[model samples]
Target: MIDDDAVGGTRSQTDVVIGGIKQMLTSGALVPGSRLPIEKDLATQLGVSRGSLREGVRALATLGVLETRQGDGTYVTALDPGNLLSPLGFLADLQQPAHAADLLAVRRILETESVALAATRLSETELAELEAILAAVDDSLQADAEMDLESFIDADTRFHRTIARASGNPPLAAVIDTLVGRTFRARLWRAISHRGSVRETQAEHRAILDELVRRDSERARIRMAVHLLGVEEFSAAHADEDPEAS
Candidate 1:
């Protein structure tokens, strides 16, 4: 079909431009912060039309590989792992509610590793900070029937975020940050609907924190994994109970 041919031609041209830029980067001819040659010049160099080159540049920009400065030119980004992996969060966010468990599974894997690293790396001050967060969480729990769901959720998120930062790996922390945001609404709903779950989750947090304080990396990892698994199970069981909840 003519439309198919047109689509194929566009794809081919984009691929050519992408390949050309990649070659330049790999060869160190286009290092981070290096401005791309003017579009016309670059198109001529790659033997591609300007339109194709622009499309390739836009794609790379979306992936955080390139940045277009206003009134300036496109340049290579710092190419940090966090920046490059950020697009993964966008994709994860797009997943259907039926796939919530899949996202939790991934979070479990990453957060388990992060907790393990934090167990060994967290300083005494950081441990104290975590303890303080747990204390606030407990206070909220003790409020019982009067518990503020939003307050407890805030403390819960801060607890996890603190541990993620203690892991000393920005990329891991960044991924966890995205996952936490994506699941926030679901988690809040769960806590509001099932008040008993708040106590259980706080207990799990205490156990995980104890392991971290003892510098028991393996136990911390296991505790984190177990805690996340419980959350995933709860979410899965109740996902079908309310189709519009998430």
Candidate 2:
């Protein structure tokens, strides 16, 4: 039910230009991470104005179909559905409180299954990666270096992603990747609100790692669920706290 006429797609020229771009992405003429022709060149080739070309690119970028580098040219993003799942994640974050919990429930379902699978299938390399991530978590917690919200969240994400990777399915890893996009950043911000939460997360992370190292998948999965549930509990308990407070 898209009204092409409403979204800068009214003109015949605009429609043709958008159609061609869609065809290119769909037909694989433009692959992920591949740079597109320069804007002027693409505009000329598609018989559209440079402004229109930029508009199209901006739209695609918003959809995670493309990424624009400030000093460099634009390129297609990894077309993995997981890569494009951020919008849904963002929407979920803004949804009703109950809906947010629902999303978390779905995440728990996926991750619990993954941890069980990982126990049966992880390769030595994958196991080592998990250990490495755990080591990084320890280092980050112990470091005197000031970790900003972004660094903390990235490190936290790497921790979970390593576990997902150890689960031995790229698709499962991707699912967790998508699931984290919404709330992981907020969780870091929440942790920064209370000094104690940071210490708590670090201790909990070690416990989860210990469970994994013991090759007890059930314990690992349960620990992970408890860890996340603790966050949910703590966040709920401090709903009125300032997320930006140091």
Candidate 3:
């Protein structure tokens, strides 16, 4: 269903801005490759102020509509998947860093019980995969200085994905993957990564693996929960020390 905001604005300003943009888009005046007029010019044309015009343009950009270039002008970006999806990462890297551990806490609550039980019911083949992931994690840890941020992140992600996959629930793992995703590497590297971060995280993973290997679902679940909670506590303390968050 189309949103009310998409059409039938309650106010004249919204109506003028939205209606004008839609008109230009539907008409050939602003084709896919065409450059948007300057903000002042657009405001004049749309019978709105520059601020409102810019706001409307940003809203459309959020919906994968426009692209702004540095020193160059704003143009209608290609609506291809690559162009459209480029905003996801940039949005993820928004200048204001959120309390990451709080987000991780929610993820832990969602995944702990499920992953633990999944580990208990894992098949021999699945166990082999988990073993392989641990091996890779260890390999990366041993070469920590040589490994780039992405490499370390990939190894760690594989470790988590292995446990999530063993849970036998695709949707659960996918959600977990998205939550503790690519942005997590940047956060973890900055916050928790001292010289000993890898060793500390490796030890934590080992403890989690020990409980899972013994099929102690309760202990495994609690262990993972505590680990994620530790991250929350760490981040909170870090925020306390930072003037920005305070």
- Winning model by lDDT: 1
What residue pairs are clashing in model 2?
none
Task: Give the residue spans of candidate 3 off by over 4 A.
Answer: 1-95, 140-149, 240-246
lDDT of 2 by residue, 22-102 (tens): 778888888888998898888887777788778878878887888999889998888776667656666545644434455
TM-score for each predicted model, relative to the true structure: 0.82, 0.58, 0.56
Per-structure clash totals for the candidates: 0, 0, 0
Tens-digit per-residue lDDT, 1-246, candidate 1: 012333456557777777788889999999999999999999888777899889989999988999999999999999887778777666455655566677778889999999999999998999999999988877766666556666767777788889998999988998888765635544434533564666777889999999998999999999999999987777666555543453
Clashing pairs in 1: none
**What lDDT does model 2 reach?**
0.69
Scanning candidate 2 in windows of ten residues, the lowest lDDT window is 1-10
Top-down lDDT ranking: 1, 2, 3
At residue 200, candidate 3 shows an lDDT of 68
Which ten residues in a row are the worst by lDDT in model 3?
88-97
**Candidate 3 per-residue lDDT over residues 73-96, each given as its tens digit:** 777766554435445444334424
